[model samples]
Target: MFEDIIGKMRGDFDIKPMEVMNLQPLVLAYIGDAVYETYIRTMLVVNKKTNVNTLHKMSVNYVKAKAQSDIVRRIMDKLNPDEQDVVRRGRNAKSVTVPKHAEITDYRYSTGFEALIGYLYLINQTDRLLEILRLSVEA
Candidate 1:
């Protein structure tokens, strides 16, 4: 289902899937941020319907930079070497600016976490992606 959606999106845009290894770390983080937020929102909505404002506030607990950084810290030891390398590449990637609300360290680490999520998604590793996402929620 995930692959189908990604493929359809690519087809719609007439864009070929880029080689994951050759893609910039920030690019991965970009998609990862969206995917992570979507997952959290979906999880929340599926559990129970709520006011949009309430849902947004609840989702923030999981999707915020500090929360993501904490989640990554808890699960880092469980990642394979390749996943760790992806995180490192993402964390070290230079960006033009940081969000005003996040600490620098939290922002960097959250970027790394998002990159790992994006890497797994791009590679079509659904099981591992879901595993990590589940762990993130638990964390």
Candidate 2:
């Protein structure tokens, strides 16, 4: 599904994956959070077509730090060496803000997950990104 969208959108802009590699993990995560939110919101709208409030509530189950942490745990071993490197950088990088209500470990894992997502999004690797996103929620 996402593949078709990407095929059409690819010509819309050009990108450099190497440039994204130079960005800070937190900067990657910033874009990643937005990418993830849009993905979840799109899934909700396409799958259920419910009211906005209900969709938002349902999205909470998937977007929370704990959930993200667990999903990243599930997918970590499946990542390739390069992807693992990205996750490692994101996991170990210090952040200025701590999660107000989430465990530190979970927050770190979520950041790693978001970093990967942001990296993929910036590089216009939509197919690979969607593949990872599917792995994220498969269970």
Candidate 3:
């Protein structure tokens, strides 16, 4: 399934096995940021049919650090040991910059949430990813 997507969208990015295995928390968050934003944008376009400004506002509500942290708090109990570990890893990662508007705790938790998404994506656990994302979005 993913292979087809990769083949069709053969862009400049390439994921080497070693990199995936030894990925840093920051790197995971980086990838997760893009993935989560893409999901938000796609969902809004498909379901809301709103203008760009409205879509951006809605997307901001869902994608902000505080929002992501709330989603993680709601869904943490549903995650398994490995997923929890990924979240913890991301939460503990050290970042140089801080979010201008969000609290530090919220930012950390949001990073953790992103790390979980990135980890699941690297493992090609699409069903699990979708399930978690659906639950989070609905919450």
Candidate 4:
């Protein structure tokens, strides 16, 4: 089912996998932000059919920078060395834009979290990605 949706989105393009390490951390975070929001939105809709406004509010609790930062901190010890390295690289990646609502530290940590998600998705590690996302939600 997941593959079907993604395949349709890619539509006849023979997309080849790129080397994950070559991608910039911000690029990873870009995709990761989308993936994370999609997952959170799906989970919320699946668990409870609420008004869109209510659902959006609920998702904010999970997707906000502070929440993501806290989730990553709580689960850091659970990550493998490679995953940790990815997160570290993401956390250290410099961004020129300042977060309007989040502290710098929280924003950076959230970027690291998103990068991990993006890295896993790019590598086609669905199970691990789902696991980490589940852990983040649970945390």
Candidate 5:
């Protein structure tokens, strides 16, 4: 389970939520990936009353790098400067993993999107996170 994964990620540090900014962008993206995946799965099941297999298929459209890249581009101008900086850092950060089907630009933007989500989740900024998520849907 993700709890076990998270426990491993903790390593030897006692990281507080507010201190997430000090972490590597890739690390933020790691946790953000989990957060985003759970968000999409939960939303789909709640709104559509779908079965697991159907929900899994539907969620792929929204969770893939290409879709996240598009969503990030659409919502970028809405972000404040601080948030934009976080995205910029994430976009520029080098990651070892790359999606075979996505363009480089799309993958970078998706990383940026995940980084933003990660930062907010780390800080417990649920309202702001949800607002951005809703805006992404409108896009």
Candidate 6:
């Protein structure tokens, strides 16, 4: 499913399995954060038809550490083995500082969620990535 999407995006995009396999967890999380946020923002605009401020508020509500943790708990059971492993790696990753108002658990889960997104994107699995994200938010 993902390969088809990538193929349609442009002729230049190629999915090299070895390249994706070499990515570090932190690098995945870094890319995933941006991908996830962009998806959230796009979804909000398309579904809610709201103003910039309203979109910002809604996006924040969904992307925050606590919300992401809740999402992870709800969807973890549905994830594949590899996805679960990715989440575990992200959860176990060490961060220098915790969010001001969020719980450590929430932050960890959020990081895991971002890592999953990053992993999917890195492998050019855009369809699966979008599907997982949609399922997560809708749940």
What TM-score, computed on C-alpha atoms, does each candidate reach? 0.87, 0.90, 0.87, 0.89, 0.85, 0.85
Candidate 3: worst 10 consecutive residues by lDDT?
2-11
Off by over 4 Å in 2: 1-13
- List the global CA lDDT of all models: 0.84, 0.84, 0.82, 0.86, 0.81, 0.81
Write model 4 residue lDDT over 1-139, tens digit each, in one string: 4444433543444334467777899988998998889889888998979899999999999999999999999999999999998899899999989999999999999999999998887777777888898898884
- TM-score of predicted structure 5: 0.85
Predicted candidate 1 versus true structure: per-residue lDDT over 5-80, tens digit per residue = 5444434532234578678999889988987887788889988698999999999999888999898889999999
- True-structure Cα RMSD, model 4: 2.4
lDDT of 6 by residue, 1-139 (tens): 3345433652466757577657667677888888778778777887898689988998999899999888888889989998898888888889887789899999999899999988887777767787888887785
Best by TM-score: 2
Please identify which of the two predictions, 1 or 2, would achieve the higher TM-score against the true structure. 2
What RMSD does each model have against the real structure? 2.8, 1.8, 3.0, 2.4, 4.7, 3.0
Flag regions of model 6 displaced more than 4 Å: 1-15
Best by lDDT: 4
Q: Give the TM-score of candidate 2.
A: 0.90
- Answer with 1 or 3, whichever has the higher lDDT: 1
Given candidate 4, what's the lDDT at residue 32? Answer: 90
Can you list the residue pairs that collide in candidate 6? none
List clash counts for every candidate, in order: 0, 0, 0, 0, 0, 0
Compared to the true structure, candidate 6 yields what TM-score?
0.85
Error of 1 at 91 (Å): 0.7
Give the Å shift of residue 12 in candidate 2. Answer: 4.6
Off by over 4 Å in 1: 1-18
